[model samples]
Target: MRTVAEVARMIDHSLLRPELTTGDIETGCALAARYRVASVCVRPADVPLAATALAGTGVLVGTVVGFPHGGNATAVKEAETRLAIEQGATEIDMVLNIGRLRSGQLDDVEADIRAVVTAAASAPVKVILENAYLTDEQKIAGCRAAERAGTRFVKTSTGFADGGATMADLRLMRATVSDTVEVKAAGGVRSLDTLLAMADLGVTRFGATVTDRILDDLDHRLRDRDGWTAA
Candidate 1:
């Protein structure tokens, strides 16, 4: 197994707080830099600033489209996706319309994701199912919808919902999505054990606010272990 520090680099260091200021995003970017994280997931309004701040760094810029609540108008979400990409965002995470999907309005749900996928173009897109609000059947359906929409990833949650990602949910999602599509287990993903466990379950990416802590734990262990082999 890889050390926690090794896995921390796959995390999209997230800051989705509504009240977070530019300074807070700057701090978040600095932390990502220190940890050599994969990317910094921030709000749309902060995307340009983050892109600029992270300039010349390997960390990519990411943002949410429909956000915690996937109830936004489809056109609105598409516009947001387009604008974010134009602003230099390397990736987009879009929330599925939970109500529509639950009601079995699969067309609307599929179209919603398709629009964003079209707008995102070459940039990878992650569809957030907010699985805590979904049943097993709905989760399966959402994964199918994401596949039909050509999304690059199927994410488990927004973390703003009552619950976040779970081992059961991640395993289910992994089973549903094709080998080509990736799974991102987000929300409630903290600590080295959970991170490594999820990675072993086929999750190549993670979204979390505990990124720094995980990296710190990994770094401390790395120093003690002499090399990553012992970790």
Candidate 2:
């Protein structure tokens, strides 16, 4: 069984809400640092602030590329990736072109992902498939495209989508990608149960807003050895 700290290290505490002020980002970064979470995934503009805030905290700084909508031109996504990395971001989760994938523009989609991966340089790039809008075949193809583009992970959902990560989708994504490409699930993973469930399905990372709540609950459960369900 995984320890609370182990699970905590897998969380990429999401600070991507649109209305979040600088104060909110500061607070979120502090919380993530306190918990020793893997990274604080912030917005493009918040990268510098997050990096500065987490400078001595041993936590990584991450950001999104093309964000909630994956329709940005390939050049734009590449620019976003390069700038974020320059701003101190090391983990990048970029949105996939759902429209292009659905339209069977496999070459375009692969090219898009490759652009971001190239711009990411040595940093890892995670491709968000927004599984809510895709069929199983599209998901597989998306995974394959991400792998071909040399991305590190195939992510599910942007939270702005109609739905978030589901076990079935995560399992399928894991099955589709090679061992070199891992999986990340975002949006709706609010509790320890949900996180561990996805972990069991081969998900290695999560974008979460409730980092403290989940980690605290895990700590309490471990201390008491209680049958907590993370509800």
Candidate that scores best on TM-score: 2
Per-residue lDDT of model 1, residues 38-142, tens digit only = 899999999999999899888999999998899999999999999999999999999999999999999999999999999999999999999989999999999
TM-score of each: 0.95, 0.96
Candidate 2 overall lDDT versus native: 0.93
lDDT (Cα, tens digit) per residue for candidate 2, span 11-31: 999999899999999999999
The C-alpha local distance difference test score for the whole of candidate 1 amounts to 0.91
Q: What lDDT score belongs to each candidate, Candidate 1 first? A: 0.91, 0.93
For model 1, give the 10-residue run with minimal summed lDDT: 222-231
RMSD of each: 2.2, 2.5
